[model samples]
Target: MSRIQLALNVDDLDSAVQFYSTLFQADPAKRKPGYANFAITDPPLKLVLIENPGHGGTLNHLGVEVESSPQVHAEIARLSQAGLFTEEQIATTCCFATQDKVWVTAPDAEPWEVYTVLSDSETFGTAPILATGEAVPDDEAIAVCCGAAENATAPGAPCCG
Candidate 1:
């Protein structure tokens, strides 16, 4: 069973835990100071709630765990067919280690990736530089926002604890 994890920043840990527990309709399987986790047995999603004192609320990222590299390729094609505009998919490393997979984006501007690495490492392969004339989709604009106007970029792209 693969798991999808989401990290959310909230103002209060207790309140957030309560709300999520009621929302998920089950008690968390794990709870620690300033952090809580609920594992959904239905769809099997693991949600992590972390208390950030002045959080200002923002979604850190979204992750999807797939079984293999072929699954990653399928996800990219699926994203493109859905018209979400993928920012060029490339074979690159991520997280400090185990950086093998593909990333896609949702129409609502959310990034989703299908990956299959388990260990945490300190180096991911560098992303290939996009050539000129590649249009960056709005969903993936956040990645190339810092003065990368020279290359035409695609959309879709993420990280974690």
Candidate 2:
């Protein structure tokens, strides 16, 4: 199934986890040192919480989590055909999982990604694609996931983890 993903930055992991668990009446699908994700069925939402202290309550990025890599590739085609700019990431690790995703920018500068998780990973990852649309180096994989401003020059075009 496909669901909308909303990634948020919170100040505290424990408190946010408790509140979201209560609000959604669901346990987190995955929880790590500074991260947590809830797969909520009723609303079909993927809520991701990243503990980024000063950015609390702020949105990290938006996305549509799909069922497979083909779905992600399909989106890349659809967006490209429509003339919307797209950055593609294949077999890249992010949010502690391997994923295939395509990124796009909204009119107001919000970053949105269409992705599918392929497998789990041991570490959190950054968008393999950098702001210049170049793949990030192996040593730089520890950067932020879905950084709000992925490209300092382009502003809203974000790199995803």
Candidate 3:
């Protein structure tokens, strides 16, 4: 099954967790130091809250989660055929999961990803290395991960907020 994913940036992890727990009537399915995710079946939503101080509390990125890597590739091909595929990440890890993803930009330059999670991981993935073999800085990586590139925001800019 596929589900809509909405990630949000919040200032306080604890407060956000409590609020969402109450609102959803359930605890987070996954929790970490600065992140929490509630996989709600009733609404079929994957709601993620990330603690990022200085970023205004707002929508971070939007995504569709599929069941398998093949589905991810199919979506990538479909989006590419439609001239929407902007970037692709294979076997990359983010948000405590290993995923294969393709990024597309909306009409307003908002980024959307169609992805499939492969497995859980203890840590967020390592720094992304560019094709030139140079490591992407953490700040830049965070921006890229959260779809800042589509809006032409600088690395570490308030893209989500």
Residue clash pairs of candidate 3: none
Q: Point to the candidate with the largest lDDT.
A: 2
| TM-score of candidate 2 to 2 decimals | 0.83
> TM-scores across all candidates?
0.47, 0.83, 0.87
lDDT of 3 at 144: 58
Worst 10 residues of 2 by lDDT: 151-160
User: Model 2, stretches more than 4 Å misplaced?
Assistant: 126-161
Winner of 1 and 3 under TM-score: 3
Model 2 collision count: 0
Q: What is the clash tally of candidate 1?
A: 8
Task: State which candidate has the highest TM-score.
Answer: 3
- Give the Cα-based TM-score of candidate 3 against the true structure: 0.87
CA shift of 84, model 2, Å: 0.7
Candidate order, lDDT descending: 2, 3, 1
Output the worst ten-in-a-row residue range by lDDT, candidate 1: 145-154
Model 3, runs deviating above 4 Å: 146-161
